[model samples]
Target chain A: MRHSSGFRAFRAIGLLVFAAYFFIPLLAMFDFSTQVRGSAEGRTWDNWAFMVTDEDLRSSIVASLLLAVFTVVLMVVLLVPTMVWVRLRVPRARALIEFLCLLPLTIPALVIVVGITNVYSWVTYLLGDSALVLTFAYVVLVLPYSYRAIDASLSGIDAATLSEAARSLGAGWFTVIVRIIMPNITGGILGAAFIAVALVLGEYVFASLLHFDTLPVAMAALYKSNGPAAMAAALASMILVAVLLVGLTFLSRDRHKQGASS
Target chain B: MVGAFQDENGALTLGNLDALTSEAALTALKGSLILSASTAIIGALLGALLAYLIVSMPPQSLMRRSTLAVSGVLAQFGGVVLAFAWIATIGPVGVLTKAMDDLVGANIYGSGWLFGLPGLVVVYCYFQIPLMVIVFAPAFEGLRPQWREAAVNLGASTWDYWRHVALPLLLPAFLGALLLLFANAFAAYATAAVLVSQGQPIVPLMIRQAITSEVLLGQANVGFALALEMIVVVTLVMVAYNVLLRRTARWMR
Candidate 1:
């Protein structure tokens, strides 16, 4: 493949400019967050250090971290089994399930929040207004992404044969889903979970509008008095999300390897 | 949403929709349309260009994989954090604004346009471009070299090959990605909520106001109708996306 010099130059310049455009603001955030607020002084660790010591910010991060864990668990548990069941037993329902899952994409979070705010008056009365209650909605929020990722994995693997193999060996439905099918599709499940976690971390609408005071909300609140510290938290959250995204790419890629065998 | 259509007596009525056609509601809707459409056009084109640039790189290159992975995260990047970054860049006392002031002796934020639609387009583009890349990058990779090679062997020039073959094949996917991008910007709430504080010039902000801000007796229902209006718009976009996706899948898959 002989590449022309002009074409190569164009790609290099194009990518460089786009990368700069995308990465510069992120870099600017890093730069601004490090510098002392209100004074033109050299960079300091005051804000980044505040991430650990600031009680409210720390609590918010911890709360969001817990929510992310719960959201991922609920998404996998609820979706993977239902998806496996649909694939193995009632394949015709796949389209309906898919449409239902992807419906959240078209329906904005604000609309869902409007319905939930109206509906969850009862839910709050019953369960109390705990941030953990936000997890239930978070699962629905992540469904479109999770379902697509999991479905791609299901498609890549011969899920039916794997399930049949377990069943013929006298495995029950639970064993089939938990032991046989899940292992084969662990890559996809992990990928979906990673993305779910990232989405939950940076989520603001449902949390802020619903008044859940998640990490993003906490950061926004902090922005009024502490600009640098808020950016620090934002930087930290973005890094965590970036790592998860990288992990997801690797996990999905790993699926291709196992996909050949199954 | 039923609450939005309810009357003063809590009786259901279409009067809340009358509010939907109000000057304020219409302004917010117009603001949303302007922001989302412009972001979609600029973001989709920028992303397509970047996707092409990445695809031009060697597949196994570390740069290619890392860029793709980072794009995935950055595409999902929005909300309060994104607003923070933009403020740091262009807001009063912002780094770039200060630097430009020092060098060019011009105050960029002096006009205070950063709080309105112009600043929003710039801020929104940050996520929009990356999102477009995440959506459209795969489409770029799906282009087979053989198509170009075969076209060339058939005596077609590069322009003819791209215009006749590549453009037709890629158009649906491009449109699909663009629509998703539109729906994304249209439905977005947090960034605008944080940045545009003068007034809620967007529907998402309007919904928030209806729900949270100065609670009038009937504004809640009006808010609900506004939410419905947003959903109706996004549904049309999604339906269009589905059609385009089906068309894309036929050729791309």
Candidate 2:
């Protein structure tokens, strides 16, 4: 095949434009965050420091991190057993299970918040007024992404065969699931956890509208009082999420390599 | 959704459905439709082009892998951080706005349009384009090189190969991805809610207003109606998307 200079130039120019479109806003976030308040020149680290020093911001960050942890825990505990049970016993329900898992993707979170007032009232009554109750909604929010990730890895390994082998050896159901199949799908579990954390951390709609002061909601509030500090927090969280998601690709790629080699 | 049909006393009624046809609700729906459609269209075209350009690189190259990884991150990027990022770029106190004023004496930040519908489109594209790339890139990769080689060997030029072979093959996947982007933008709330603080220019923002401040005690049902409307629109788009995906899958294998 012969390469044409014109085609190569087009590719280069196209890539450059895409790069600029993506990177400029991110760069501007950093630039805007460091700009000194009420000054035409120079920079200050005060805004960056506010991420930790501000009381409301600090508590919100903690709340969000805890929410991410709880969501991951709940998603794994709730989904893994049901999914494995379906594969082992009731294969007839696979379509229904798949549909239900993917249903949240179609029913936007905004809709859930709007329609969930009655359910949340019961939840708040039982769980008190803590923001951590958002873990339930976050689990539902991350369902489609986590389900796809976990399902892919589950399919990669022969779950039924592994469970059957363990069963024949006189192992109990708990051990078969927790000790055998669970270890085999560690990569998928981790991928799911990473994605859940990323989504939970960045989530704003449910938390904001529901009157919870999570990290993103706090950032919005902070944006009004202090613009530079809000930009600083926004840039910081964006960097963290980018790192986790980019790391996710490398993690999955390494798993693929390990699978091939073994 | 059942709540949308119920009145304040918890009795079922059709009054809330009537709220959807009100002047305010109609305008908000129109704004949402315009925003989602424009962003989806522009995002699809640009994202498909960018995906093709990236796919032209060596499959395992570091640049290619990083670009794909970055695209994955950006496609999922939304919410307050994204809104703030745009503000930092072209908002009133944005860095570029100041830089442009200093260098060329041109004020790009005219009357704070970054907080309006046009601003929403540009900001929405920040995530929409990357989403299009993530969903559409695999289709481009699935284009077996042998097909292209076969086309070229059969007395076909590059233009002929793309027009006759690639374009038709990619049409279903492209349309599916476009619908996915539309549903994505339509259901989005965080960015719009954060950007447009005053007016309820879109359905999601209107829902927020309806929930927060009620003219009557049970006026919040209007928010229910609006949310139901969003779900209906998004569900339709996603169903069409799934049908296109199934068609694309038949040949992709």
Say which candidate scores most in lDDT.
2
Give lDDT: candidate 1, residue A175.
Answer: 95
Candidates in order, TM-scores: namely 0.93, 0.96
Candidate 2 ranges with C-alpha deviation above 4 Å: B1-14, B214-216
Give every collision pair in model 2.
none
What would the per-residue lDDT of candidate 2 be over residues A1-262, giving only the tens digit for each residue?
3458998899888888889989999999998889888755898999999999999999999999999999999999999999999988999998988988887888878888877766777889999989999898889889898999999999899998999999999999999989998998998999999999999999998898888989999999999889999999988888888889988999999988988999
Candidate that scores best on DockQ:
2
Residue-wise lDDT of candidate 2 within B60-136, one digit each (tens)?
78888888899999988999999999998998878789899999989999998889999999999999998988889
Best by TM-score: 2
Off by over 4 Å in 1: A168-170, A260-262, B1-14
The residue-by-residue lDDT of candidate 1 on A170-210, one tens digit each, is 99999988988888777778888888999999999999888
| Candidate 1 residue-wise lDDT at A2 | 62
Candidate 1 colliding pairs: B4-B221
